[model samples]
Target: MKRLHLICLLLAVCCQEITAQYRVAVIGSSTAGGTGAWPLDSAWVRRFNYHYKHQLGIVDSTYTLAVGGYPVYKGMPGSYVPPPDRDGPDHNNNVTKANAVLASLPVPANAIVFVNYPSNKYEQYSIAEIMFCLQTIYDSVLKAGHRCYIITTQPRTGGPFDDPAVKRKLAVIKDSTIQRFGVANTINFYDGLYNPADSSILAKYNSGDGIHYNNAGHRELFERVLAKNVFATPLPVKLTKFIGNYSNASIALQWTAECTDPNTSFTLQRSTDGRNFENITVLKAKGLRSSLYEFTDRQPSPGKNFYRLRISETASLVMSNVILVKNPQEGLQVKGLYPNPVNQPDLEAELLSAQTYSGIVTVLNTAGMSFYRKETNFEKGLNKLIVPVQFLPHGQFILCIRYGDGNSILRTFSK
Candidate 1:
């Protein structure tokens, strides 16, 4: 049997060697510090340490740098006061504290840092402001060449001094942005605790005060983190082929993998526009051996169809490369714009249509905000449209074509 040389295809895949020791760091405030949870060992952080060891077989060294009552953002004048202990060398500056905490570790590389901070008290800071602080700390850790994870603010009870509206708003703000940083890099504590209907922390999980967790609460958090299995050392699964092709008004995807884990499954997902995706189906592994898998979409949407797979095992989620299938048989199809690195304000897009249609062209920034929008008509067959972008400032932008037939194509270009 020919063994698939899968390692070469993976980009810097990290495998645990016999001599390698992986470190896990927990950086947050009292919430992550195990505050209100008796005998700190029962704190979620400590529970995570146990799971990392037995579940992942990692020589995990766990460290916590949580200052009780610390705010993730710097204190604003006349709004909130810094914790008394903030005067220490770390200064309670989230970025400074994170850097110091990480630097103090004996082994920094190959380390995963989980940052959790409660936003209950910081009513003055908007979600965007808090996100900026979290991003700063995240960047600092990344600059040091380590993987960093951020936790969304958990549900809390509004207190007399604490404004209920602000706490809820901040929690939501944190939840939305942290996940966007990286889907795999975030530990979603908010979802595990917040009541979906009321947007409050579930009563059972909430410590009577509504800000912290009880034993059961901590345990629930521990379970969610364990479910992610991010700490698990990856087992190499080589993929020799991953291809998507259009045929007979359908799109078919096929891939071959060599893996020894029997408890593996592949979730095939499809997307019309590249950004949002929907699961098509799931394929389970035949056994702890090599296998070939295939899926066909009988009725794919017109225009560009994107396909990707999420591979799951006992402890990891691996993403496959995205493949595109272009079908210009029924709906409007827009091809790439020329001279993408445009030096001038004039840009052109190539459009292909099977029927007459009209649609809008929108240009968005990195923030997903539309700065330029215009409606245009497409004739049956091929058509070229010239767009004027000279009014836009210098930066990157996404061009999207939304047709009347509920078909759209998106492409990113710079000017």
Candidate 2:
């Protein structure tokens, strides 16, 4: 009888280990950073973490990489440099950095990521720009092999946020965020907190500063996140490795999966802009406990190629981590422009060079009129050229770079 009891106990332990909770990472601004909530413990993120660990009967870990008064720009990738007027990325709070940190842990692959930036950039950035930033962050999170939940913009009172036009724009942003990420993947932070009359934070939920929420409001936010039931679905497969190598005019991709179901299917997808992906090929799982897959792309995009795998099981679908393979040639090449749809005074161009060469960078108008020109030298490997566009009129312009070897590149940007 004791031996049978011991066997049952071991089985119970194994089941507990298999059913471990999800690891969560939150990248957000002041609200998520616990700014408005008095005593901090009442903050939504903290409350969520507490409920997950205590009420849920499991020790799910939650990591918050939020900073006070930070906008979407500050939470961008570390390599991303904001336009001249904006602040650069904060590595500690950046979404890319947070993803990396979470990935290094020995946790389940289906980590939960929360992106909450509420009304931080309403005055400084246009709705389009704000959407772009949010989309970039969301894509990055998805590419990192995690589930992302974007929190909608909450209402803010006083200052410029009270303007009817600004409120309308904020509403547009909130709706756009939901429409873009889908309702299932978004946490509604604006529903009960905002007053319908003026679109400002309700008095009961306001933290008295008019910008953030109090303990009651934070509780409401926590409730919204809980209502999503993001943790209900169980991950069907585990992707152990997803990597790529570039060589001999072709790129080779390989990935390994563990504990995959026999009905699983893998769809190899490629992207040039990292936002829109096109399917390359699809393969069925080998119906093994562990499996390895490989593919090669003979004709990769000239510059950077982004690759990811969509693993579809009978009940669950997930994406592998995005791998970037640069296909560089022997001459001067213009990679791309940063902060596209330029709003700041200065625009930066990323260039890759095989050998040291002198280059002339020029900004030309639509009618071929030279608006700005600069003569600069590019060293071998990657180079960045900053083109001043403050003087250029508000319109679309072309950037042309003429190398000493007679190789020229042309790219377009907007002011």
Candidate 3:
């Protein structure tokens, strides 16, 4: 009873530690002001606030300080500029407005300012000018010991930015700035909202004018931001690949990782349904610059086997994409290989055997050159095996498996 009470107390403390409270200030233009988004609450900023409070379990207060025709920089006289101070009344310069907003925050140190540059208007600001204004705001925020997240401009249908060349230039600036700040510090709203086919606003999410977003657009924007900011777990290890193959009545999980730190490790997870996963094993890190990791589940489910990898770090765990492996159907042939085109050094193949047999596996190019040959012992049921084809050139190839019983089969694959 005493131990149980202590465990509960520890769990409570951990939960409290993970739940961080924040004050997010959305500073931008009409889009940030919930313009064109029906019912107001469906706006991206509001949806993000809701998600923060519910999905992330974070107690965050959001405030929008956006106005129509608001540009990040102080444009030239003819350009769209904010009202200037008329001697008695202070001219609301972009920087001044931001400063006022930041000053009003009760806890600036714990605040994260979301600054969206409203450049998709009648006149587009030069990248240099925009960066200068952004740098100014960022410096001010840092001086106040607060963090700032900048949102790049979204696509527009008919604005000056609609020109492909102009849009590309603006994107270059946004991309460079985000790279400077690191992926975690900026919200990539452009990537979230831009239509790849024509570089216009996605039809379903647009409010017809291309400058504003509909409710669904706003929700999608919120979801994308959440994927990078709240839901994502950043890790030091770069995961190159996480895949699986089925054979020998089990599933083999393979992964390639570039471990920057020697202490990095991984936990392999298995799921039958792909939705619910269970940690199958913890593999020790190779602790090298580049390493290959593999784990085999000797008893996978009969049908589809889903696998993922979780890199264990000092502070958090980073998960990989799920890969599926399935037992081959009853046959005397190779079932399948994951990532068929093959990006890694090896490919895993699932083979079904009618009886216990010995076989020779060979991989040949279209030119008939046998680049790889290996002998394997197959069990009566399902057998999983690895065929090294990293040395083969990138193109089409054929895998031939010759059994001692004189039965041979060939399957085509691409490198």
For all candidates in order, the CA lDDT equals 0.70, 0.80, 0.68
Tens digit of lDDT per residue, candidate 1, span 1-415? Answer: 1234566434334433443366766666787889767777788888877656655657446767777777765422222344474322244535455455556444676677777876644565556657766777777778767778778777665663245566557566755765668667776676536653445677887777777888888986776576566655565666778898889988888999887777888889887655445688999887656678888889787777888877877765566778888876658666658778887768888887765566888999899988888977788788997878888888999988888547778888898
Off by over 4 Å in 2: 1-19, 105-108, 233-415
**Clash count (model 2, backbone only):** 0
Tens-place lDDT per residue, model 2, 211-256, is: 9899998987876676466776455788889998999989999998
> Total clashing residue pairs per candidate?
2, 0, 8
TM-score of each: 0.49, 0.52, 0.48
Which 10-residue window in model 2 sums to the lowest lDDT? Answer: 101-110
Look at candidate 1 and tell me the lDDT of residue 229. Answer: 61
**Candidate 3, 83-109: lDDT as tens digits:** 353111123534344455556444566
Question: Every model's Cα RMSD, please?
Answer: 14.5, 16.9, 16.8
* Models ranked on lDDT: 2, 1, 3
Say which prediction, candidate 1 or candidate 3, comes out ahead on lDDT: 1
